[model samples]
Target: MIAAKFQTFLILLTVLAGTALVARRFNIAPAILLMLSGVGLAFVPGMPPVELPPELVLLMVLPPLIYSASVAMSWREFRNNLRPIVLLAVGAVIFTAAMVAAATHYLIGLPLTVGFLLGAIVAPPDVVAPLAIARRLNLPRRLVVILEGEGLANDATALILYRFALAAIMVGHFSLPLAAGEFALIVAGEIAFGIGVGWLSLRFRKWSRDPQVELTLSLITPYVSYWLPEHVGGSGVIATVACGLYVSWNGPLLISSATRLQGIFFWDLIIYLIEGLLFLLTGFQMRALYEKSKTFPLDDILFATAVVLTIIVIARFAWLYPATYLPRILSKSLRERDPSPPWQWPFVLAFTGVRGAVSLAAALALPFTLPGGEAFPYRDLILFVAFGVIFVTLIGVGLTLPPVVRWLGVAEAGRTEHVAEHEAEIAARRQALDAALKSLDALTAEKEISDEVMRLLRARHEIRVNQLPDSLDPAHHDVSAAGTALTRSLIDAERKFIHDLLRDGQITDETRRRIERDLDLEEASLANREYREGPL
Candidate 1:
């Protein structure tokens, strides 16, 4: 059994890496490809079925994903786009749930509560897949922000609603007023708790002073924030988001440069493995669901999945237009402060509602037997529909989103804006360097400083300043690109020479490693500089 489990784990890792590489090479969405690959692998002869535990995702996987994304998000951008985000995260989730409940109850003859449970499960759009596609396409910054912000918070809304629906089903009673009040309290409490965790964790990290210890603290912080709120009936998602945002805003000042440097590489690798493995595991469930389907009426399951898929897609469209424009019509202050966006913006938003692993996890977490030892209502059917929704949305929308953006011409504006942003970034770098020089001069006057050291420091600053382009004109950009390419070639030649020295016994391994590390850092900075200048 131990050997079998280890083999299964190895198979999953291999497939994940292979599929991700293929996706990148072909310009396909990794989520879609990884999932499809998993499905294909599941039915191979002698392959074991790998069941994804609900607790694994909810308790173990969710926190870090949310935390990392929240940290990456700009607090100012999130705050500026609060209204739209709330409209989607809170309002749209509830509206979609209600619509699904009504449609499933009246049209499909499922009980209202059971229908609501299904609704809650599928309401929130998965951020991982859509955001990946959106950022690669360079959609408008506001659209990306709104999508990310909604992704961060909507799970809290959906999961809270899921709990209510489950309770209503189990106890055979629910109160609208009481549930509403409780929901408000959970949101508030989780936010406070998450912030508190962030504050305490930062202070602890500051005290630790060891880079490895600080990195370990950062790893555990998300889980600590998530688990406490969730154990007490609150949606831990909100708290995790709050904690991440707090850390993002304040971490620069408090976190040591050594920790930050190590932490970035550490978190990047962790998130990459987790996301790839998740989508693949989600697809592995197809074989299990396929076998289970033998017990149910095939037509009934298919018809129900089709109905729910249609409703999920339509509901987003129905809700987004009014949500986008209605407030501006009613409130003069709102209109003045934030003007309405183009219709195409809302259209693209509606089109990107791809469901993912979270919905399937929720459906799987359903009680196998209720309080009275009876089977849960529509459990199998709900799982089937949830998986179906994930399949259709992930493949259907994920594949077509890029062309849709192209046809709509939305990304053209974003590309133009990106060029302008790049220019501003260049100006800011020059200004910041000037300020640093002034501070260095003041320190030299006040404290003991040698002339040689001062000259070296000033020269370093001047070199960086000279690297900035005078303007982002086509001619200047070409020259900059050529210089960058030539610099990379020179770096490669130096690396070859260093390797030859090590091979010829002219340098010890330790000495070679030290030189290699410096070279790697320089190459990484060059890559970052090119990215900031804008996509090639």
Candidate 2:
């Protein structure tokens, strides 16, 4: 097992290093690169299977990954898009599960209980995967919001459904009325837990001035919030999300910038490392699927994959097609004006439904034998299908996303000025260095600064200020331009790393404080892309 883990680690290093170097030098999604590498590694010989405990899987991989995604998501955006996210995450999960479960049981001749279990497992898309691509692709803010919000919330919804399904399977019965009551109770409980935790976390931060204690307290929030709901027989997934949203929205006002940046950075790296390892594990387990099935049904596995993938993709549109406009239509009758837009580009959203670590964790968590000691019917089938869906979505979406945007005119025609503006922004940024060097003239007050000090300062100053073409006009430079998107991402990634240390409680509060200020300044420099591109 140790050798297997080390081998997994080594492969991840090669993949991440390759992604870092290429993405650093050129503009592209590192996720796409990573997945492609996984695909390539699969075809190559000598890649060993990696089997990990479900407990280790969730603990090691989830907290940081979920936290990082939550931090980047603006509270304002999430609230604005809440309804749609609910449709996708809450309403959609049940809708899809029912449809899939019904189809699976009757069509495939599986027991109703096993069928629902199948439905629950495939309900949520990979949250980490889409964000990784969205960052690199420069997807529209609103669209990205829909994806992220739905992705985050849906994970919880899926988990809740899974729990209820598991109970039904174990206890030898399920009640529609009882399920309804349980659903209502779960929803109420989750809301109460989330709202309560959010308020408590904010109060803790507000009352506590010590950044060290504050950061430490914050680290425990996600896990505690997550499990609190679970312990009470509620949904932990939703609870963690609620806690994250609450903390993020409240943290800025109560928590210092230094602490926030530190937390953000620490979690970013933690998630990346976790995801990279998990995906490689996701891929490595292909052989396990084959081995687990004694009466192997290649045709059955293939059929299941095709069916599950079909349900996931179709069910998204199944919910989205009407949900998008039903609210608008209702509101139009009561309001003076109708302004909301139709849910365009269903194809883009549908295809982004990649499964990942979460699904694997859930599948692995399944009981080897049910309460009656009968074999978990078709356990290998579910894992294989889930894995196959993940592969299809990751590659399918990654490759087609760019064109889908273009085809849908998501990249507004005649307005793709980002590439050029990015180029110009890179050039005029020299003034930043010039300002720094000018500010340095005051640093020599302690002494006619030593020659070595002067030399070092001047060299640093010159390296920056000298890079800009001396005459490049800043006035004409496009403020909306994004330099090679890849470069921007790498810079963001590095900044995130510095903070991840703080978030994980691995660094001093003092260091977190400093990095927070740096993050703010860096953010300010690049924060106006929306205004730069739009009309009032």
Candidate 3:
């Protein structure tokens, strides 16, 4: 079994890597391709079912991905959008769970406990996949923020409710009052754990100072947050997310720009690996789910998956109907700031809340047999249905989102502050070029170079400088510092591309790695300027 599992796993990895290389060429989302690959694998003969150990899955995958995502998110963006985040993350989740529980129980004829369990299990959307797709699509930042916040927050709430339901099943007692207390305790515990871990991370980062060492420290922080809370009977998912948010919001005030960029890339790759493997493994866990079917009918799993998926979608829209707009209305009524929230994007965000590996892991984590040793009730059904929801949300929404946004007449404009700054920098560059021409004219008048050379330089400068906006007088000025900065940023982006190409074998290896050295020089120059003037 072990040898078979190893060979099977290696084959999946090899296929995924090859698929990724091809996906890169076609600009396809690897996560989607992996999902397709998984489907294909299911049809292949002699493929072993994925049997991930519950603790290992949560520990190995969840922490790094959550932390990496959190580390990449800006504190300002998160805080600025906190109100909407709360509405969707906390409010929508609770509403969705309750409604889904009600709907599943009545419509599917499942017991209330089973219905609620299904609700809780599927309530939290998979942040990793949707955010990956959104980023790839270049969706609006506001839309991404809402989705990330909702994804991060809902997971915790769902876990708390799931814990309560699980406890009820095991101990043979269900009490609202106790569950309420447990909920509060879980929230508090997660918050406390996050704060504690974040504090430790910050101080350690500060003391380490070395980019590589700090990076190493960062790699481990997620595991600390995830496992610590989980081991103590707190919400591991919540703690991981909370700690991530805390770090993202706080780490910058305490770390270097180099560290920040490096950490961002590090986590980005880590998330891709973890998410890809986890999703593929979601297919793997199907085997374990199958083992649970000696007693319960297969129809139960089918009905449960169908019932839960419907409710999850229904609950999202139902909650979103009120949740997205209420805050906007309240802000407007009270003459509060930023009244024009992206109310239209909620549906896209809600639909993107696909259940992925975590949901599968959570379901598989349930004790294989109940307290009476009758085998976990409907375990295979739960796993099967969770996978079903994951599939529907990812592909269904992934394909629909772009066309829908365009069709709704609310296609998000890509007009960020950075873009505005880019325009300003263009104006500055024109001024700089004009000043250079003036100096060139003086040198030419002094007969410093041949007329032909001077004429050629003047002609080249004019053609390029002519492209600048009419508002700026090139004859009288130089590019402003802001313009210089903007131009540098554009250069840096190009440099990064070069660096990635060289690193990824898209470009030939050189004796000295010219692109890498160029990037290093550019980076150091940017830092030295920062040193001269305090960080912006």
TM-score of every candidate? 0.98, 0.75, 0.76
| Over 4 Å off, model 1 | none
Query: On residues 1-536, what C-alpha lDDT tens digit does candidate 2 reach at each position?
Result: 88886876787788877776886576565665666666566556777555656666665457556655675678898998787788888888888888778877776777777778888888788887776676455655666788899887787778778888888888878888987888778777776787677779778877887667777777777777777677777767666676678777776788776666566556666676777766665665655665665577788877877887787788877777677666777786523453555344445566577777677777788887877789877777777777777778877876777777666775452234454554567555766666776678766764577889899989977755643433324433333244424445766787788778978989988987787766666555454543443221
Q: Pick the TM-score winner.
A: 1
Clashing residue pairs in all predictions, respectively, total 0, 11, 1
Q: Global lDDT for candidate 2? A: 0.70
Instruction: Supply the TM-score for candidate 3.
Output: 0.76
- Looking at model 1, report the run of 10 residues with the lowest lDDT sum: 527-536
Error of 2 at 232 (Å): 2.8
**Candidate 1 local lDDT, 485-515, one digit each (tens):** 9999999999999999999999999998999
List the candidates ranked by lDDT, beginning with the highest.
Answer: 1, 3, 2
